[model samples]
Every structure is written in C-alpha cells, then in structure tokens.
Target chain A: GAGVSQSPRYKVAKRGQDVALRCDPISGHVSLFWYQQALGQGPEFLTYFQNEAQLDKSGLPSDRFFAERPEGSVSTLKIQRTQQEDSAVYLCASSPRTRTDTQYFGPGTRLTVL
Target chain B: QQQVKQSPQSLIVQKGGISIINCAYENTAFDYFPWYQQFPGKGPALLIAIRPDVSEKKEGRFTISFNKSAKQFSLHIMDSQPGDSATYFCAASENIRGYGQNFVFGPGTRLSVLP
Candidate 1:
C-alpha cells in the first residue's frame, strides 16, 4: 500500500510570498491532519480534516494559514505572506477513520522563508 | 501552553543497555497515549501505544509503562541497539466524538545508541 506523501520536499520563499504544500493521503483514508515541526521540536498540530469536512482549525498559528481537502483524499496547506518564523517542516498524516488513533505520516515538506 | 512534558532532551546508551524516556501530562481527560519514532529526513511512525486501562504493555523489546494516578508514562527500550537511535515523541489525546481529539505532544527526546 502506498504511504502518505507530500510534494515539493523542499521549498524556499521570500518573505511576504505565498506558498502551498500538497499532501496525498493513503487511498481511502478518511482522516487527514497537518502539523508543523520546528527545528529540534516535536510536530505540532495545525489542522485536521475528516474526509472533505474541515473538523478542526484551532491549532493553526494565525490567520495566514489555510487548509482544504475538497476531494477527501488529498489536502493542501497554504501559507500566505510567508515569514521567516514560518521556516519549518510541514508534515501530513492520515488515519483509517475518524476514531483511529494510529496515524501514518508523510515525509513532509520543508519550507524556508528568507 | 504545552500540555505534555518530556524529560531528558537527549540520551546516549551503549548496545545491550537499557534506555528509558519519561513524559507527563496534565489533562486527565486524555485517554489515548501513543509514542512516535522519527529518523532524520523522515516522518514520525507509531512505535507503540497504551491506553489508561493498562498499567503496562510490552511489544518485542519495547515496553510502555503508564502510571495513571501520577499522570505520567514512560518508554523503556531493553537491550538497546544502534539501529534504535532516533527521536521519540510522546503524545496524548482525549477520545471525543469517537475521534482522538487535540493531541498534545511532548518536546521529544533524541536517543543515540552506540555499539
């Protein structure tokens, strides 16, 4: 079975620019989550989706962050007006169903804002 | 605020020795506890998990000891090997609406096993 995967393994953007990171969850996965991991820190939850419905967005750091999962299998995390503080690895994970606690994670997209 | 706190930011152990990492949580509502292992340039993978119902669970050489009354849990690696070196994260979540909600992660512990 294919594992969850993220695109643009690495990205560099200038401050004030916009960036979008993509995630492809395992086929048929019903739960998708986004997390941010800073250097030497554990991953922090940013948002969560159950199928196509965005269930939780409380973990999003600020209004500049947005996420969507229109089709339920793929998701995108968009950061507007990127800042140097946003430089970190963006990780995506998925689970079988809403209640499943075991999450399978993607390799993650490392974003650097200059 | 960070709900979970992990101790020993880093650890080094020799092969065949025992390795232990500890974590504490403040929320009593957290019912599901899971540990994740991550290597450089890779995403975290589920190492092992335990619920509040169990005091301890062992899988192969990895063991999780949970102390419900103290709101603490720990991971013990027996006969540590070089390949076991990586970063370990402890996380907790409350079962809400049939889903594990609002996971709180610890700071993480970097473990290095020397042969």
Candidate 2:
C-alpha cells in the first residue's frame, strides 16, 4: 500500500474484555510504531519495532498491553482486560529506516471501553 | 515523563493573521524536531521539520524557529487560512536511536482560523 493502514476503525469493548487492533505499514517500511491518544491529547508513544524486532516497549502503560510484528510487516496491538481509561485512539505509523526519517500515520483505531 | 511541553491548548486566529505554537523540551539529546498537522477524523501529517543545526527553516508559508540553547522550538503559520485550522503537534527525537525510539510529543495546540 502507499500508506500505513489500520483495521477496525472503531471498536467498543466491555470492561475486562480483550481486544486487538491491527496495523499494516507501508510496503518495505523498516520501522513501525504504536501510539495512544486520549481525547484532546497528543499521541503518546507506546512501542516501536524495527522490522520484526520489538526494540522498545517502554511506553506501554501496563503488562496487559502487548504488541507484535512477527513478519516485520503487519502488526497487532492487543489489550487484555480493557478498562475505561484505556479508551483512546490507537495510532500506527511507519518509516523507511531507523535513521531520522519521516513517519507516515494511519487513520487510527478509536477504541471505546464500556 | 513527558519530555516535551506545549502551550496555548487552543487558539483563535483571524484569516491572514499569524498563528504561532510553542514547544519546549527537557532533553538535550533530542536533535530532530518536527511539527504535525491533524484534522478531525484524520491522522496527522508532517508539516515541517528542523534539525538542531539550523536556527530556522521556512517552507512556503510555514516556518520553524529553533532555539538550541533554550531547548525550545516554535511553528509559525504566515497568512493563516481557514484550511489551516487543525491540531498541531511538536515532536522531538534523537538521531542515535531508531526512527521509532523514544520519540516525544507535546500535548498539542488546536488552532481555529476564522474568516
């Protein structure tokens, strides 16, 4: 694809329920990132992947939040036991390389925890 | 902790006026700064970027002013237009790290350009 793409543009999950969001980065992009944005707030970095390597997960709020890019292309962010506070737009971005490169973002998945 | 801080959570500017948004960072390791513009229901798009080596950079009607000593940066939109109304975010990153590593973003500033 020409740009990064995310699945399930909107999702509603009951409290304690599990949900998974998917992201497909631009073809051949070597770097992928995940971010969380609350209402009216900026996107907060959650994790980063260099190809299939999960290099940084420092920003994940809790142990329940997990992300993986097994094939170095498609990625998925899974949240277990969702809470109301977890409600936000999850953004996915990708870049060409590890150097100072421009990141392209997806439309984002708006998750609502009820 | 948030490495970057932004001001003027919201602003109203008349068309043809200038819109300015400021951001400050605490980390000196940051060398790259970029601004993003986002409209409602859409993802953010890169507007302009500047490196620490340059004090200022201009592209079309957008300008980025950098102050390495103060660790501050600002975005200036000349002749602001209604189409320019959107949320702007300032972000910083270190070159030593990978593209997605430790990228810090400010809280964001929403600009409303009125005709």
Candidate 3:
C-alpha cells in the first residue's frame, strides 16, 4: 500500500512570495495533519482535517498559513507572503481512522525562503 | 512553553551497548505517549507507543518505560546497532472526544550508534 506523499520535495521562494505545498494522504485515510519542523527541532503541529472538514487549526502560526482538504484525500498547505522564518520542512501525515491511530508521514516539502 | 522536555540533545553509543533517551511531560491529561524515529530527509516513523494504563511495553529490541506519577518516560534500545542511529522524538496527546488531537512533541534526541 502507498503511504502519504508530498510534492515539490524542495522549494525555494523569495521573501513575500506565496507558496503552496501539496500532500496526498494514504488511500481511504480519514485524518490528515500538517506540521512544521525546524532544523534540529521537533515537528510542531499546524493544522488537522478529518475528511473534508478542518477540525483544528490552532497550531497555525499566523493568518498567512492556510490549509484545505477539499475532497478529503488531498491536502494543500499554503503560505502567503513567505518570510525568512518560514524556511523549514513542512510535513504531512495521515491516519487510518482518528488522530489516535498510527500516523503515516510524508517525506515532507522543504521550503527555503530567500 | 515546551509541554514536553527531553534530555541529552544528542547521544552516541557503541554497538551492543544500551541507549536510553528520557522525556518528561507537564500535562496530566495526556494519555498517549509515542516515540518516533527519523532519518536524514525522510519523515518520522512511529517506533513505539504506550498508554498511561501500562507502566512498560517492550517489543523486540525497543522498550518504553512509563512513570505515570513522575510524568516521565524513557526509550531503551537494547544492544543498540548502527542501523538504529536516528533522531528520536517523544510525543504526548490527550484523547479528546473530537475529530482532532493536539500532540505535544519533545525537542528530540539525536542518537548515533557507532559500529
């Protein structure tokens, strides 16, 4: 079976530019999550979606970060007006059931803001 | 505020030795404790997990020791091998009756096992 996958493995953007990262969750997975991982640090949660409805987004750093799962299988994390501080790896994970289940993580998209 | 705290930002152990990484969490409501392993560019993989109901859980060479009262947990790798070298992260989450969960992760410990 295929695991969660992310696209544009590496992305470089200029400051103030906009970028959208994509995540394809496992087939039939019900829970999707986005996390940001800084260099030498643990991953921090950004948002979560169960099916097509977003359940929690309190972890989003600011208003610039937006995420959506329109069809409930693919998700996109969009960052508006990228800043130097946004240079980090954005990871996506999915679970078969609820968030309590084991989560399969995507390779992640490394974004570098210059 | 760091909800979860881990010690020894990095660790190095020789083959056949034991590697131990410790973690402490502040929230008592956290019922789930899980450990994840990550390589250079890959995403984190679930290594093992334990619940507050159990004090210890062991699988193969990995063991998780949980101290409920102390709010601490540790991962012990017996006979550590070079292939086991990776960054280990400890996370805690409460089982809220909802669609989402808030997982608080530790700073992570980079483990390097020497051959």
Each candidate's TM vs. the true structure?
0.97, 0.97, 0.98
Q: iRMS of each prediction in angstroms?
A: 1.3, 1.9, 1.5
Query: Candidate 2 on B66-95: residue-level lDDT in tens?
Result: 999998999999999999999999999886
lDDT of 1 by residue, A12-82 (tens): 99999999999999999999999999999999999999999998999999999999999898899999999
The DockQ scores of all candidates, in the order shown, are 0.76, 0.64, 0.74
Q: For model 2, report the TM-score of its A chain.
A: 0.98
lDDT (C-alpha, whole model) for all candidates? 0.94, 0.92, 0.93
> Where is model 2 chain B poorest over a 10-residue stretch in terms of lDDT?
B94-103
Instruction: Kindly report the root-mean-square deviation of model 1 from the true structure over all alpha carbons.
Output: 1.1
- Binned by DockQ into CAPRI classes (incorrect, acceptable, medium, high), candidate 1 is medium
Clashing pairs in 2: none
Where in model 3 is the C-alpha error above 4 Å? none
Which candidate number would show the highest DockQ if scored against the true structure?
1
* Candidate 1, residue A65: how far the Cα is off, in Å: 0.6
Pairwise DockQ winner, candidates 1 and 3 = 1
For candidate 3, report its TM-score.
0.98
* Cα distance off (Å), candidate 3, residue B90: 0.5
